[model samples]
Target: MTMNERIVQPQALLSLIALRDRALQAESLNALAFSMANDLYPVLHFHQALVFAQRGEALELLCVSGLSKPSEDSPYLVWLRRASRWVASQLPDQQPHWLARDAVEPPAEIAEGWAEWWPAGLWCVPLQRHDGQRLGLLLFLLEQPPAEGLQQALSGLWQTWAYCWAALTRQRRLRRWWPSRRQALLALAVAGALLLIPVRQTALAPAEIVSHQAQIISSPIDGVVERMQVRPNQPVEAGTPLFSLNETTLRSRAEVLSKEVAVADAELMAASQRAFDNPQSKGELTLLNGRALQRRAELAAVEAQLKRTQVLSPRAGVAVFSDPNDWLGKPVVTGERILLVADPAQPVMLIQLPVADAIALEPGAAVTLFLTAYPLQPLKGEILETSYQAKASDDGVVAYRLLASVEGKPEHARLGLHGTAKLYGERVLLGYYLLRRPLAALRAWTGW
Candidate 1:
């Protein structure tokens, strides 16, 4: 009752009363009601108060004040919860009630430091819906003696609290329903307008060419990049020499070893031929000839090292990315990315389009891309790629990435430039685009 003045203010009450309209959200009601209960409770007593919510729940803490959220969930509150459920279940009508008038006393088991606050009288009251359907219960636990007139005041305030709860809860349900109803009517009006107006819109579809995209390319081998020859935006042909590594020592040793290996191989072959003529010498040649094979293998290893000195391009593309800060003249290790060459002849557009809209992009669709850098120019691209792979954003929204290809050489276009595309796709009626996602989510949630 003490907190009732602020809680029952005209504005908040109106918000609550609006709940029954079948057009408001239950959360708004819950929030407003929680706020009122919070403001009202301290006026009554500072110990603590909670305006809990219910579903199948007899009551769940909707909001609380007076006790900082318990460092741990308070056991006393836990006891009240079980007891409330037991009591509500016993009633023929769904509502909260006096689960325990004095059946149990607060025990040390309830919370830490409980010995300081001994046995207290506790009670549970029902929070009923406007139609008198019970939604949850209200619990009151206090020192052994509730002060004079306190019981009366609480009882009087309980009705107001219940009204507030019912109004707010219903309003929540209404907010959602009303929007849906409005949308239905709006859709009808839109359909009517479409029938009356003569207009045609072109359809759009995504393109046929999509490429795998990666940034921050890594090197394939572990070696110091002795040299870096490519510059930013430098276009290189496939297998073009991009850089080289120091192989002076490796090459010279390889040549010397190769000559020795060739000599050994020649000697081994001569010995094998001689052994073939002497039938009993077969075993002798096997043991004496393996050195030639081993030496030849060593020579091949040197030759491979010589080849790795000249780093070659794996693909034909423009080296659009080479961080000067981390590049050439610097000692780089194997697997370090010296450069990134995106497929220049076949550059694809990457767009993170929302699923709601992306679903409309039919395969082989067309789109218009406009770049800010070239405001006067427009490019045609096709949606050749749509990935079903969706990722959840930090805020928990789902989105899919799409790839579209521009038709020709991109003049003044740069990688990662901010550009917008008006993608054309299937010609669905306008309302489907607006309503489908929400309707789908609702159906999934309700299973109806």
Candidate 2:
């Protein structure tokens, strides 16, 4: 062996072992790359070091000596990448070698930037796994060539680094695939348990306050309403006149019948007086008398209809209806609902549950009402009854009507107070409770 090929000093050997230990102890590929580029300055005696790792079909610069992170867009780095690619292509044997500007002919672009960015001598080291797969490249710039013994030492040292690099790279790949497989499994188990939690099924619907035992007032006869005596929600006594219907037709009919009755009576009397002189007159007298009785009955019926034109309240309560103008001049049929005589103190909840939001509801189901007038102070009630058939509500949506009695007589609650009501049903899994509507919508859309 030549004199320059002698083994390194004991101190240098210790330093080499220490560097290998540090590289093996590195937690990540980045830490190892940092150590290879920066920590090797004291042992290798190089002016600058650039570390590159193989990424797919390209070489990616990982780090630079004395820089925590190298800017890939910098002019020097851009040029170095091109130079590294050219060097990587030339190294078919994947071995450590020395490079100089004049020793190897490079492409025109790489040759042009060599003098400005690099020194006279350059050492290229390709880091590879035991199976000969290229892992990374290390380019060390030197003002003077490294001794043959140090070169041999570096070759062995990098082999150890390649092994560590390959190990770290495999660990990094696993980390990218899944951060922690065990923790992910634990989270899935927790989520499954949470899905099984029991929760009560509930639905929201629009509700209103109405009287429990209210009297529905309807038209007694078919006539046009001429006037309304009491206003909406106005308090009144049992004998109070509620409204008056038009009496023009009834009065005219009564007057005509009265005149007809008088004429028939006069005919009957004249016939009776003539009956004494002629037999024909006596036969006409019976017909005249029957005609007079018929006219009188007709007049009595007309008078009775006239008395019915004036409507009166049957009970003492608040008159609940729309505006008085709605009734005035409007013709109504017999038994058509006009207003309601309801007791304000006996208030109950009326819920119009939409068909889409309807759930399994039973009598005496718990109901919580949030009144629009008194939103902060909610009222509690229980379902009394529910309509078996769905019908168009006042808002024009198909809904089922539900009646619920309030727990106590609340002074603040009155007729016509509207709000939202929450109805609770049987308990079910939390997953089912939350996914009920979504599942229903999905089924509707997919027809499944």
What's the lDDT of the predicted structure labeled candidate 2? 0.89
The TM-score that candidate 1 achieves is 0.44
**Highest lDDT: which candidate?**
2
Q: Which stretches of candidate 1 lie over 4 Å from their true place?
A: 1-221, 237-240, 246-282, 313-317, 324-347, 354-357, 388-401, 407-410
TM-score of 2: 0.60
Q: What is the lDDT of residue 32 in candidate 2?
A: 95
RMSD of each: 14.7, 9.2
Taken over the whole model, the C-alpha lDDT of each candidate is: 0.59, 0.89
For 252-308, candidate 1 gives per-residue lDDT tens digits of 889899898888877777777878678767776775577777887888987876777
TM-score of each: 0.44, 0.60
User: Who wins the TM-score comparison?
Assistant: 2
Cα deviation at 245, candidate 1, in Å, is 3.5
